[model samples]
Target: MHFELGFVLLFSIATAVAIAARYFKFPYTVALVVAGLTLGVVHAFEPPHLTKDLLFAILLPGLIFEAAFHVEFRKFWKNKLAIHALAIPGVVAAVGVTALILSPVVGGLDSVRDFGFIHALVFASVIVSTDPIAVVGLFKALGAPKRLAILVEGESLLNDGTAVVLFTLIVAVAGGAHFTVGGATMDFIRVAGVGALIGGGIGFAISQVIQRVDDAMVEITLTVIAAYGSFVVAEHFHYSGVIATVVAGMLCGNWAASTSMSPSTRVAVESFWEYLAFALNSVVFLLIGLEVQLGSLLASWRPILLAYVAVVAGRAVVVYGVSALLRFTPERMPWSWSAVLTWSGLRGAISMVLVLGLPEGFAHRELLVNMTFGVVVLSIIVQGLTMAPLLRRLGVSGLKDVYQEKYELARGRVGAIHAALTALEALRRTRDIPADVVEQLERDYQQKAAAAEQELSALKQQTNRFHEEEHQEGVRRMLIVEKDALLKAYQRGVIGKEAFEHLVAELDERLAKVKDPEGHVPLEQSSPSLPDAA
Candidate 1:
């Protein structure tokens, strides 16, 4: 009953938060934290009995499996550079700087354990890993340019593995194990290599399994197994669990998307993961928000604040400095990417989880936990809330957000048709098809295809309208739905407000183009381009 009640409370709060976020334009993370904190305080005396282990056990696999099962490997390969920068070195820099800058406050705080620099660095290490899951809602809601969003999200996902591996290494060192920077580098590389190999291996095996089975249930179940199993196996071997999941998801999501899995199975798997990710994210962040005791933090606010300032400064340096060494092009990577990377690099659930997971009675554990919570809160509320607006100010907008939206909608329709056709063929092999019935089936397919085309046409028209500077009536009618989707996604924690507002502007511009009609180009024909979101 308690278990059931917990989920119910979670679902209800998530649903409410989703609705509220749509209207408020506050960071979804911020709103959720505030909402959760309010509820947690109210129920502080009788807090929900959600164990960290069950959460890792049940939700982790489902969430990971779903993401891996649908990732577009080809697309991931295209933006691998940005993904690497943000995921690897970015994490290292953030951790190093955060620990160094925040040491005085953490060490000086009278109540918390006094910490040596190494321990402080461990604190930085744990806290620097960003929780992409917490902020994915913002990405999808605003229709951030798919590539940019992909980089942020993909980096976050992969970096979790990197962070996990690094966390392990640091924890070992902090435990009085001998450590050298060179050994750390080798350990990091080896873990990453092993993780990739294992995840890719799982993806290949799953792909084969998918091809041999026509059962949607079987295929979907296999996908679920693939996600969690891969992570578990990777972690068991002390490899990068997150990277394994990312690889597995990319392989299954893209390679086998049109090839192996039935459409029904894909839908079931996607739906399951989507809900699972949402639920898991809710529990994780909600706990982070609720677990925070204000008094514990306010007592040492000075050093925490100074540490935060230094961390941000470090982020700025990392962003600018790293970009110089990397192969990121000004045209492709854009300066805006750097700016958003610095600001949107909010750390939350991961930090909280790491802090809580540290060994009980560990030296400086209390101080570390408190400071970790402090930085996590600041990142989520301060950085998360303002990420979108900051992106707009940097002249980066979610203009091509429609491409992914339209593409997803179209892909779904196409996938369904393909699956249905496969089923129909299978049925035909087993039974005689009457001439009239065959004709009827063909006609039915035509109707379905026609309907899909009509929907695509409408979407394309809306897309075209957004690109145009003038007006058209037909475009305006289409925009009502588009705008609503953007708004709903933002509200639902599927995208960020900055992303939403930027896309909304584009949609409005398209509506204007339709109204004017003369300068308009058809959405289908016009290649999508990135514009100054501001």
Candidate 2:
């Protein structure tokens, strides 16, 4: 297919799938894959192949960067222990366990050929990276805890790099290249570390540039440069490009975007990345469906089913094992989360691209490819469809009530109208427009704001969670005000350095509790009244 025609077809299919999925209340990405599968079975107009080059050079960086960009570093760091455990050693363990389980089983299968421990290891490495896009979206919609979502997302970001590194090493060893356990560990460290440095340097540079520029377009462009540039540079030096992009995205988002960009510029940059993520997800999921051949999948159904079971079992062992180890730590989660974590390990485009990238001369390449594709499809369809019910069954669905949605909409309207009124007042002061017209506009906005507030109040009465959330927000703002005042006092020499540090430290402790009140006092138990600085 011509490049232009292919994209149009892909996007058209994506749009149709999106609309239909939303209307039918289905998972959008899964729906896209299903659509692509139907089209593939029918041999619909040829679509562009989702090759390794396309994924690494384009899709992977964008998707990874977008996820990393929105991830608040504070939230990520709070769960750092669990995230790292699940991502690094947990992944490596899962890979080995999967191979151990599958190697014995597959060696006995009559249909499978030349697939042993080494081959199983390669397949395990390919499928171990969890693609959390679908599950994360579901978590947000179902009102899962922010920390839970962060753990899932944060782990995925790091594991993608880890799994890719592991896959490369295993592939080399399988290809008869000399390898040792210590040598492999060193290689992983060197690649991952260099990639982090490269990404962090690029991200810091981009952030510095953003601080000097006010234009939203330029800042957005710089973020794009940071995402792709970090990946390209790291890859040029044969380091982990996935890790590089992820680190660059985090730095740009948390450090640069927060410290430098104006609110409007930040919004613009975020909105741009959001849309890019959606578009990339749409095309990639669709391509995943299109890439599969039903005939081949059916022929290898037995091995695929076995491989899928082994993959799930491997994930179960790793997640539960980590949860057990964390049981005594501050980062420990409920037993239920282990189950959710295991189920959320859906394979995605990265696995597909990795398997496809295998050399044609590689032994058992076709079998490996079929097994990988089969597991990816099964995971998406089976696990994706059941995740919501799992969340509900486990009592982790925090709040799916419509009242919260109504409250949020009303609250947003009030804030937007207030901003508009503030802008109008500034214009009136400058005499940029007639005072009477400005006065009339201000009156209109004030009325709308009043109505929005009334609606918000009505909704709040219907849900205690909304009220608690508001109380938390109010307390946070007051704490921030206190911190700001203390900083000003110290700068102006109105307070001794010791006094300032002590006061600020107390305020910061309070702020941290407010931000992550997991073990702190429940919001509903406290007074909803805003704190008085005096």
Candidate 3:
């Protein structure tokens, strides 16, 4: 196929699968993968040849940036311990265990009989990093806890760099590069540290530049430069590009987004990145499906099945074991959270990229690639499909938070009524309004106020029956919204800086209290009045 035609077909497939995903409430990436597989099976069109430069240099940076940009910095910090534990050591453990378990069986498989522990380790390293796109998408759609999502996402973002480094080092060892524990450790540290420093420096520089510019287009363009440029620059110096991209993204998201860019510019930048991620993800997952060698996969079915079991087992050990170890820490993870984390360790594009990059004559390269593809498929199809149901079973599904939504709606109605009444009173005093007009407006406002009051009262009564945790979550969410509104009001010059700062501080205090279970106070119990909108 002509390059343009192939691009168009891929995009068209992405669009169709996206629509189908939405219509059927399926995870978008999972749907795309399935669609790609279906197309491949029927030999509908040639899979677009995804080059390493295209995948890593072009597509990956945007996806990483988008994920890192949206991560809630506070939540990420709160869960940093668990996230790092699961990402760094967790990745290593998964790789090691996979190699150990798969090594003995390698000699029994004709395709991989020549492969040994070192080769198996290289394969394990390729597949160890979990792909956050599909699982995180499902988590968002299912309304999983914000912290849970952050943990999963933060781990994935960080682990990709670690996995890539490990893969590189292992591949080098397999190809006659000298290896020592001390040397490997130093190399890992150097790569990760350098990548982070470069990324942070680039991010901070771009953020500073962005603050001096108010044009949304310029600001968005600067961000684009930061994402791709940081990755490319770091990679050129033999640093971990994935780490660089992630750090740059996190900086842009938490710092530049709030402090440097105007609200409009921030929104535009975010929307652009969001769309970029969606488009890239669509292409990546679809290509994963289209590029699968079904015959090779079938030929290696025995080893692939064994690898799948090993992968799952590795994930379970990491999640359950880490959670257990962290049980006494501030970041102690719940067993339910660990369960979701375990099942969500889905492999995708990164694994495929690593395996495909293997040397053409490398022993077991084809077998490893097919097995990695099989594991990715199983993870996306089986685990992705069941994530929502699992959340529901564990009682953490977003549906359980309906009370919080109802409370917000009720509060919005009350606030709107108040605003309308205040506006009506101000207009009556300032303008030459007729008595009839004033009376009708006053009556309308009064009825709406009454209805809003009733609704708010009913919602409060209903929500009072919620479990303590749920009630606290509702209070925390309300406080966050209130703080956000105050900040926006300040940004728009609707409120003075002093008032905004004071109000936000007050809200923060309340938020802290609500978050603290020991001294928790419900919003209604603590303060019946909303923050002054003036």
Candidate 4:
């Protein structure tokens, strides 16, 4: 197929898959993978081979930035020890165990027995990095605990960088580059440390410029530059571009988003990144399916099966071992959480990119690639499909009941009515709308608000028959969301300043009543307020 036609075909498939995913309540990433696999199996059209440059240089920065940008910095800090343990040491442990277990098996295979330990380690490094896109999507859809989601997401972002560093070092050993423990440690620190420093520096500089500007378009453009620019710059200097991009994104999200950009600019920047991430993810996952070589994979089933088992075992060892060591901490993790963590560590695009980037004539390259593909496919399909049910089995399922949805809807209705009243008042004051129309609108809004308020009151009473704590948490989340909506409306000029302040004050007061004296809501609370509208 011609390049233009191929691009259009792939995009059209992505669009169809997205719609189907929504309709079926399927995880979007899994759906894309399945769609790609179906097309590949049917030989509908061959996708162009994915290059390492295309993935790391072009697609990866945006995905990493968007994920890191949305990470709750406060929550991340709270779980810093656990996240770091998993992301840094956890990666090392997983890699070592996988390589150790698979080395002997690879030695026995006739096609690639000579590849030996270092080659096995290289393959291990490729698959050890967990991609949390599928897992996190399910977490959001199922309303898992906020802290749990944060830990998983934070760890995944960091581990990708770690895995990449390890893969690079192992590849060096396989390619006859000298390796020593001391040298490796220093190299790891330099790659990660420098990347972080550069990313932070670039992010801070961009934020300073953003604070001085009010144009949404320019601000959005600057953020786009920051994402891709930081990654490219870090890579140019041989630093870990993944880490640099992640740090830059976090700084932009937590600092620039709140302090530097205007509300409108912030919203635009967020929306732009969100769309970019979605598009890139769509293409990446779909291509994963189309790129699968089933015959090669089937031929390597023995090693593929063995590697899958090893990967799972490695994950279990890391998760359980880390949680055990951290049991003495103030915030002790539950065993159920450890189990979830182990199962949720699905590998994806990064693994494929690393495998595909292996030098030609490298020992067992084809076999290793096939095995990595099998593992990735299995992880996305099997683990992704089972996560929700597993959450339910563990009794940590965050699914909200129908009454809770109705209550939330009622609260939203009240907020919407208030916003309409505020807009009507503004119009009347300016005489942009006639007094009669404004009065009539006010009456209509008032009636709707009263009805919604009454319904909410009844729902509040109904909560007494259910889990009081859960119900209260839901109410608190609803209030937070309503406050955010009010702020956005004011920012967008849909609500008057006075009304926005009033509504926000009311929400804050309500939130205060529900929260503990320390102002910390339980981490187990579900359905956090939506992102503050720019």
Candidate 5:
């Protein structure tokens, strides 16, 4: 099919499937994967295959960008220890368990009764990463806790990198490419390191430039280029393309939050990514359902089941056994958290990519494909659909709820700030806001910004033109001290002193700015109230 026509057809199919999934109260990602399986089957019995480079090259960058760009890095960090436990070593251990137990069932590798250990390892590692976009979306719709949602989502994000690195090493070994612990380790380090530098460097540069500009359109376009270009550049240098996109995404997400971006740019970029992820994920899954060769898959069920058992048991040992040790000791992570980690693992598209991606002439490719496909189908249909119930059974509360309450509160603050900004916007049109309030707003916003870019984006052209670094920094320093004093007073239970001092400080500062642009006042002049506030 022509590229344009193909996209239209793909989109149409996605739209139809999405509607059905939504109408039936089903997970869209699950629905889409089923749809792709159907499509795979259709192609299996036919002359042509639906899986192609276009499905990835055209759709994937935007999807990756959307997920990475919008995900809050701060929250992801909050749960990194737990996320690593479940995604990284967890994947490797699962692979080992599957290979050891399922060997007999898979049959005859190198004229023997067992599937080769290495091959099974490849399949397990490849399938270990989670794609929870559809399930997470449902959680959001169901009003799940934000922390659960982020834990699941953050793990998914990191595992893509972990899995890719693992997959690459496995593929190299399978293809009889040079295999060395030292070489492989070196290769991984270079790929991950170079990819991160390229992606993060570009993201940081983009953030810097974006802060100076007010145009939403330009910022969105830059993000698009960052997503695709970062991948291509990294891949060209033989680095991890997925990691490049991820790093770029993390950096961009950080900037999106800070005052560095215009409100319109933030909204535009967010809207663009959300839609893009949906479109790509939808089409990818639908094609999965559309093109399945069910009978061929059925033929491979024996090995698939065996492999599934191995993987599950392995995951259990690592999750419950090893994790139990961590719980009783220094880490002190709740046992309930580990239980949620096991159930929360929901694998999707990337696993399928590797399942189908084995080179055509490899000796054991068919067995690998069949077993991989079977395990994936089970995970998606069986484990996936039942994850939430399993979590509740294991006593894991919805982290999404925690996140939602936090989000609502944060968003409320955002809303109020937006109101202030709107008021500022209106004041721009009409000289209603006092001149002092306007200047205070600009410099005050700058220092609190998470990064430099956010604060700079809030500046008016006039502020830039008449910019005085000396005056701006001094004003910023004074305001911060006064703000600190107010908080300290509140903490000390001296409400009257707090109010009186804060009010005097605010009035005097505003008056001082009106009096002299270059003069400064230090925060230390105020009597301290409480240590925490200071």
Candidate 6:
């Protein structure tokens, strides 16, 4: 297919799949992959291959930035120990364990007995990065605790950089580069550290620029530069581009978007990125399906299955190990989260792209590709299909009831009606409409607004869940106000340093409990005492 025409076709198919997925209540990304696979099998016009160049140069930075942009650094930092442990060392351990387990099993197979530890290690590294795109949305939809979602998302965001850096190192070692434990450790630190520095510098610069501009388009363009520019510069210096992009995105989203950009501009920028993410995700998932050769995959089903099992086992061990260690910390989570975390490790585009980028003459290249592709497909289809049920089984899914939806609709209607009334009043003042007509319209809207508000109130009365939600919302707002006041008081020297820190810490704990109500004691039940400044 012509390059231009291929994209047109892909987007059209994605549009159709999106509509169908929504109608049938299916996971849209999964459906796209399935659509791509079906179309490929039926010899639907050949789509452009999902090349490493295409992914690394274009799709990756945008996707990473978009995801990272929305991640509040405060939330990410709260579980820093857990997120870092799982993403950095946890990923490395998982890779090593996967290799150790897979090498002997695959060596025992008569078909490819030569698949050694290094090849297994390489494959493990490729697949260790979790793509929780499918599951994160489900978490929100199912009302899972926000902290749990943060852990999953924050880990994924950081691990992508770790996995990519590890993959590069392993591939280098495989290609005859000298390897040493100390050297590799230092190299990883330097690459990641320098990338972070580069990203922070670029992000800070862009944020400065954004604060000086009020135009939405200008601020949005600056963010785009921060995202791609950081990646390109870091990669050009042989550093970790993924890490650079992620850091840049986090700063821009949490710092620039919040403090610098006006509300309207922020909304515009956010909307643009959201649509871009959806578009990029659509193409990537669809291409993942088209890339797989069913016949080849079927022939390699034995290794694929074994590899998949190894990956899962490896992840499970790491998750449980991490969970055990976390039990002593403030960040400790329920043991059941280990199972969810392990199962959520579904490999996606990064694995596929890295494997494909391997040199043509690399040992067992085709087999490695086949194994990576097969495992990616299996993980997405199998795990994605079952995540909701898994959440239900674990009792982690919160408020998966109809009342939540009805409450949301009623609340939205009330807000919309109020906005409409505001607009009507503005028109009544400016337009030459008759007084009686204006009065009639005003009465009509008032009645509609009252009806919507009453409906919302009744729904809140109908369920404690609604009441709890409203209470939590109100509490969160008040806590934020208190925190803001505390910050200003400390800054103005109205409060002592120790007292400010103590009060702020208390407020943060309360906020955390409010956000993850299922995991912590309710604020109502906790000691609510505050100490005075000395």
| Candidate 1 ranges beyond 4 A from true positions | 1-4, 22-28, 48-52, 104-114, 327-332, 399-534
Off by over 4 Å in 5: 1-3, 36-52, 108-114, 325-333, 391-534
Residue 391, model 5: Cα distance from true site in angstroms: 4.1
**Separate clash counts for every candidate:** 26, 0, 0, 0, 41, 0
Give the clashing pairs for model 6. Answer: none
State the displacement of the C-alpha of residue 467, model 5, in Å, after optimal TM-score superposition: 46
lDDT accuracy of residue 315 in candidate 5? 67
**What TM-score fits each model?**
0.74, 0.85, 0.82, 0.83, 0.72, 0.85
- Give me the displacement of residue 1 in model 4, in angstroms: 2.8
Q: Residues 444-525, candidate 2: write the lDDT tens digits.
A: 9999998998998888877687778778778987886777787676667778777776776677667656644343222222
TM-score of predicted structure 3: 0.82
TM-score of structure candidate 2: 0.85
Report the error of model 2 at residue 3, Å.
2.7
Ten consecutive residues with minimal summed lDDT in candidate 3? 518-527
lDDT by residue (tens digit), candidate 4, 1-534: 786787788889999999999999998889999999889989998676667888977899999999998987987887888999999989999899888888887688776558577877898899998888888878877777777888889999999999999999999988899989999999999999999999999999988888898999998888888899999999999999999999999998999899878767778888998898888888899988988978888888888888899889889998999999877663457789999999999999999999999988987888889989999999999998999899999976768789978876987898888988888888988999789988988898898899998998889787674346556767877876786677677777787766666676666667656843122343323222334335
- Expressed as tens digits, the lDDT of each residue in 347-445 for candidate 1 is 766566766788997886776777777888888887877766776676665545656567558758967876766767766776677656766786787
| Every candidate's lDDT | 0.70, 0.89, 0.83, 0.85, 0.66, 0.89
Off by over 4 Å in 6: 408-457, 464-534
